[model samples]
Target: MRVLITAATFRSHLYPLVPLAWALRAAGHDVRIAVQPSLVGDVTAAGLPAVEVGRGPDFMSELKKSIDSDGGTPPGTAPSIDKIVVPHIRIAEAVVADLVPFAKNWKPDLVVADPAAFAAPAIAKAAGVPLVLHTWGPMPDQLWADLTSERTARENWPKDLVAFLDTWNVELGPDYADLVVDPCPEELLAIRMAKRQEARYVPYNGAGVTPDWLDEPKRRPRVCITWGTTSEFMGPEVLRPPLLAIEALAGLDVEIVAALGKAGRELLGDAGEQVRVVDWMPLSMLMPTCDALISQGGPGTVLAALVNGVPQLVVPQISAQPLGAELLTNSGAGLTLRPDELTAESVVATVTELLDGDSVRPAARELAERNAARPDPTQLVATLADLAAGR
Candidate 1:
């Protein structure tokens, strides 16, 4: 069987699909990733074959420019349709022109895609293949509603998208896929959903080497602080909160590891000996060694902490994070602080709770058990094959 998976250029967009790609290959089915030209290297780095389709600037780099100009979309809130969703739709229009020709020639049996990849449905339609929708992580219930909202209302679409739809010959719809493979924790996603296939959240931190710090024994409780990649590009001001967190966490006996990539490290030079700041540490490799985490509420980052049984202090920066952070806080697996609520005192208090509070540990353990109980990607191999075979 041949399976073609599609994603946009962003690593956050591409990484969520890696485990499934690995699953398909392990099961002996041929798999290929078709993405914008810039993302071809990332597709190959994950050991998956890549087919480039069309061109676009690095998605996040473009977004960064928008954010810098208009200011961020307020921490904990989703970006408005114009600022966020429309750009993606525009990209899809460009990529599908190239993607459809490849899909026709490759003749894949199944098509899988990240939520942001609007081209997948059209390619599936063109090839007469089953289309699978994969989510990046658990989303806010309201955000989920926005994503799954009314389709087939083509007349209501913005004029530009309407034209794009006509050109692509595919109707505008939320999640235009036959099967939805979702990896959100069930408790975090309580809203009734359609065509939902629950899958485990598996962390893919890119191909990485283990840091030397993991080799040393922990002399104290360890806490990881990370801002994922988007915040790094949003501007230097985004690093302020972590720097504030460092000040708050100082004098505590805890060891701090801020895995803020190279640019983040360069922005924050020498965070003292007690604070080990490094670029490019994988959360899947680092989280198991830590007792707690502080991050800007990215779905992948939050799940990485949860799956490892580590409690967290989440400071939601943008997009779906605010909702996911709220759900995590409600689940008792973690706590959330919105942009307005961030401070040195707040950061210190939350980190203290994660390390010393009794409420968080038991919840964290239970969430970990639930994550482990869910079928991993390797287990989902037969399911994908069955979907392809229409059985």
Candidate 2:
């Protein structure tokens, strides 16, 4: 079987799909990834065939600009309902245009797509292929409301964006998906919402496949801190506080490994004796050793921490981060602190609180165990294959 996997231009979007693509290939299916032209190298590196979609822009630059323009809120900061609804439509429309031909030409038996890359489902409909929508993040209520209001023309988005996304609604409304894989656990979603779709409970994407670096034993309690690669651009300024805060916690018999991207690594100076800074490290590997995680609350990071059974402290930079932090707080697995309000004392206090409390540890352990018990990727791929075969 030939499978075409589509994802948004961003790395966070692309990485989750890689493991699944590899799994398909291992099962003797022909697998190809349609993504931004710049990410062809990453796709090829993972041994998946690459198909270019968009004329690539510097993703980090675009993200930084968006974060700057959007005014990244500190942790625990919530976005106004309006901001979430409008901008995403514009971004998705632009992304969808690039992806259409890629999907049409590949004409795979199945198309697996990130939620943001709504174009894949549309193309699959047009090409008479099965579609699977892969959602690795929160399904925003604002987005649902926007889609629901399509008929009445009620939306918070600008006229241009609304017009663009509406085109897909008109083009592929009924023939959308055969299946939807919500990589997030059911505990994350308020309720299932898709019609004629099965929502599978898969663990966070790109999580828990151990890397080669973590086999070494360590003396101190290890703590993993990373604000996804997007944070490098969106919340570069937000990076300083976490680094500084960690320095203060150096005395607590803890060892810190901070995964900052290129920009973050440069900005964060030497991380001293107990703390180390690296340009990048696999979260799947680092999370298991870490006792606690400090993050910018991106969906991937939050889910990675949850799947690894590591307690977290979220400093929400933007998007659905505040919501994630809220969920963490509600679940008794973590705390949320705003960036502006963050101090060395606060970071130390929060880490101390998590360590002292049994709830954070046990809750995280329980959730991790639940996620670990989920059906493996082979089962999911077979289920998707059955959908494609119209079984």
Candidate 3:
């Protein structure tokens, strides 16, 4: 079977699908990732074959522009969904123009796409293939539905576009997809969509070399502090949590490993000797040894900590992170602190609690067990194959 996996031009969006892409290839299916030209490097870096499609206004730049125009929302405040979805719709329109022709020529049997890869439904319709929506976590279903309706009318898109999507079981009116591959634990989800297939959240933080120190046995409880790669793209003011977290953890008994981009390091200059700062380290390789995780509430970091059964202190900085953090807190796996609520003392207190608390760790372990009970990506290959075969 031939599988075409599509994602927008973001590493966070692309990484979630990597394990599934690998699983399909390992199962003897032909797999190729279709992404905006800017993201080809990221896709190839993950050892997947990448096909660059349509070039135009980049999604991140447009989103940053919107944020700049809005004078920036406070930390932990989600921007209006249209601010997030409109740029994606524009990009998708461009990508679909290019991708439809490519899909016709390549003739993929199935199309697995990120939920925001708005081009996929049309491409799948054009090629007469099954479309699968792969979600990173809980999505704003009503927000997406509203955005799609508003955009379609404003762009004067064909009324039959939604009808064509319906042929594949996609209902844009309610933001339903033919099938959804969800990697989140059931308890954390706020809204459950129909035709959901559960998959384990596998950590894939791109390729990186593991340092020798990481392999050596730890002398004390190790806590990982990270704001994730996206933090680097923002201004310094947006990244106060990592600095506060470092200060909070500095005098603690635990060993701290801080993963910050060069920019982040510069902003939080002279992290004391108590903190070990690296420009990048694969969390998948590093989380196993950590007693707790302190992060800016990026989904990848939150999910990585959960899968590793590490209790977390989440200081959400932007969209979805706040909700993700709250879900973790509600699930008994972690705690959430808004940026305004964050302080060195508060971070220290939370980290200490995560390390010493019994309920949080056990709850994290239970979430991990629930995640593990979901079907592995390799196990999902047959389901995709069956979907491709129209079973």
Best by TM-score: 1
Q: Of models 1 and 2, which has the larger lDDT?
A: 1
For each candidate, the alpha-carbon lDDT, in order, equals 0.79, 0.67, 0.80
TM-score, every prediction: 0.91, 0.83, 0.90
For each of the candidates, give the backbone clash count: 0, 1, 0
Kindly report which residue stretches of model 3 are placed more than 4 angstroms away from their true locations once superposed: 65-78, 141-170, 173-175
Candidate 2 residue runs with Cα over 4 Å from true position: 56-105, 145-162, 165-176, 195-213
Q: C-alpha displacement of 97 in model 1, angstroms?
A: 2.0
Summarize candidate 2's per-residue lDDT along 235-308 as a digit string, tens digits: 46656766776776886878888777777677766767777787777676677678899888877787778887
Error of 2 at 154 (Å): 5.8
* Candidate 3, 280-361: lDDT as tens digits: 8888999998999988777778888889899999887666777778888999999888877888788888888899987899
The ten-residue window of minimal lDDT in model 3 covers 153-162
Ranking by lDDT: 3, 1, 2
